[model samples]
Target: MLLLVAAVGILAVVGFVTFLKLSPQSTPISSQPSTSTKEVNALSLYHWWTSPGESAAINSLFGVFKNSYPDVAIIPAPVSGGAGFQIFPLIQSLVNAGEAPDAFQMHAGYEARPYYDAGLLEPIDALWQSEKLESVIPKVIRDMTQFDNHYYSIPVNVHRVNVVWYNQKLLKQNGIDASRLTTWDSFFAACDKLKAAGVKYPIQMGPTWTASHIFEQILASQGVSFYENFINGKILSAQDPTLNQALTTFKKFLSHVNPDNSTTVKDWDDAIRRIIKAEGAFSIMGDWANGEFKLIGMKHNTDYGTIPVPGTNDMYGLCIDTFQHPKAASHPTNSDRWLKVVASKAGQDAFNPIKGSIPARTDADVSLYDDYQKGAISDFNKSTYMYPSIVHGSGMPSSFKLKLNDIVDNFVQTQDINKAAVAIVNQIQSTLPEFTKVWSLE
Candidate 1:
């Protein structure tokens, strides 16, 4: 029953790191390209942004950097995977071999933990002070970028996770008021109506990770404090009534999703497309799906609309993209220059519009953003609280995050609430020691 979602997480670590480096075609790039040497001459960048929207979004930033550094060649080295699954492992290999790129893309919070712990990254607190970013960027975001009281990365964009994307026409045709469907009880009641009206699957879902992604949102709906304890490894019992309640809720939610036997989605976007085709009424996805809607010439609030995932109206589930300079970067000065460009208001403005996320900078140029983004920006500015997303690798450790997708997948196929609940607790208990950072979201 568990569905409604978010993605871009693949903290899919270690096991695949070796294989990716061994395969030449899979290896994204070397630190020094044998093309440019000086710090200002060229820069090798490693990131996982190979998709159409993501590529163009990054290109916009490239354009900004090019305008300023007219002589320096910007060598892009993007890995082809969602959320740096292949790229992070490759970085591990590159750093070990003394071939780390000048800079690389990383998620804001816990994703940087392993790198910082291993002495693989360099802190840039001085840059923050020089640019006076402390006064502009939100404190919570700044806190996420720091380790032991120092800044290490610059957040470029913020993707809200607690988003419900619905086809406006589909809901209207079904006589379901999405605004009224703001609680699980009402959501399921609407699902019942859709099913009775021959809408077999009222909710669309995708691969395993989407289910895990949905599970995180469901858990967060309990409360920010509950989610904080969860990420900090506190929920460790199937007997905990609230934990089981969340599991039960997920099961109920999955019931509304398209059954795997008759139909299956290729990925998150495929599920989103189902809503566009009127094959489904809802999809819980990140705002990036808005980019897809915009690309197809769909209008916000007319063709599609978004609400915070039920019960999250006052909160923002933050999944941020940040950039950092590595310790042994091939071009340190060029890497420094790249970080400067990424931190600039111009870089965030150009990248976030295409990226379908709001700019990380507080004073964003509103005119450049679309209706959906403008709403998100407003929600972000005044949200009750913001929590890092586990599905997107900002909340939990890699070990637990990787196992979560399988756990959610198994639970969906089996619909075994007790088993899933037990599995979730057991995994947390085992991985508790790995969850070092004490997140104070609430």
Candidate 2:
């Protein structure tokens, strides 16, 4: 009886040990899947920077990524078109065809909002958290890229939208000192001098979007709080007397622009040509225009001087650009590796200088930039004068942009101030619903 009981006990112990070995939790470590070993092989990147200078700038970034990941091959697919032409249609087609690149550069505004809403954009929240981008990029830029508590895109640099690039020789010839013109009245006074001196086009303006940008500058100078209130739908219409005054101020400036000014000159390159040849005494445009000036061998603060848009106290505004990542072909590992490299510190440092804007990273040293860029960086540090570009913010989607373009085009052509004001009011009323919907989502 004792031997039979001992034999049963030994069998039970052996059975229990066999069951433990077969359990899922007890699988050998080598047999389990490992996430760390995953690798990316190749990446396809798409962007709209075809200009020689822009290509050079972007190549520097690509070079750095290659250095870091020599094993991962990068295929750059560049799309031609300066900033504002529609590239979305092409991207939409590619996505529908199941050929979306691993990553593409997009605007930071409502232009990107649709992609985020559609779930086409991969939320970089996980990557941002891992990299602590919040601590690296400036709060303003970080805030601009984020929507609904998540970052949708990365801003490579910040460009001042409300800049008035002027011909130093032209201004001096007219005895008009740009320094004394801090307010709208003084700015208009200078324009009057230019006009009186037979400067046919005292201001070079064009591109439907640029007209809207000018309107935004006027609105911001009035007071960004006022602009925000209207944009948020707190003030329903432009019927407010303040709105009328802003419209009037814009119309007055419109009168001094080129007579042939129409949306037809809807290209920055065309505007640059007019400026370089001194056909237009001044141009109210973004700092990116500096690239054109540089190409023409114009010296900053000498051949041309940059000033805040007339009547605005701030020298800074929206900074916009795109980042491209390698396309994920057969190798998911290569695609992932390229994404990681673009988001790294070395990548930003290599790209921003050639791109002509301060690095999106706040910790970057601005001393490496040119004098104009250094000044821009210093002004941005102040933070008090900064506001996002309207086109980059709520001002874009409300269809108010289209209406403002119409108003400016009309005001410039016919000089009908009252009609322009009324048109603006109607646009405000029509755009309020869309504007409210977007802001509420925020």
Considering every candidate listed, which one attains the maximal TM-score?
1
**TM-score of candidate 1 to 2 decimals:** 0.88
Candidate 2 segments exceeding 4 Å error: 1-42, 50-52, 69-85, 263-266, 322-341, 393-428, 431-433, 436-442
Provide the TM-score for each candidate, comma-separated: 0.88, 0.79
- lDDT of candidate 1 at residue 241, scale 0 to 100: 86
Instruction: State model 1's lDDT.
Output: 0.81
Ten residues in sequence with the least summed lDDT for candidate 1: 1-10
Q: Extract clashing residue pairs from model 1.
A: 1-253, 1-254, 1-255, 2-254
- Error (Å) of candidate 1 at residue 361 is 1.0
| Local lDDT at 424 for model 2 | 68
Worst 10 residues of 2 by lDDT: 1-10
Query: Which candidate leads in lDDT?
Result: 1
> Could you tell me the lDDT of residue 146 within candidate 1?
90
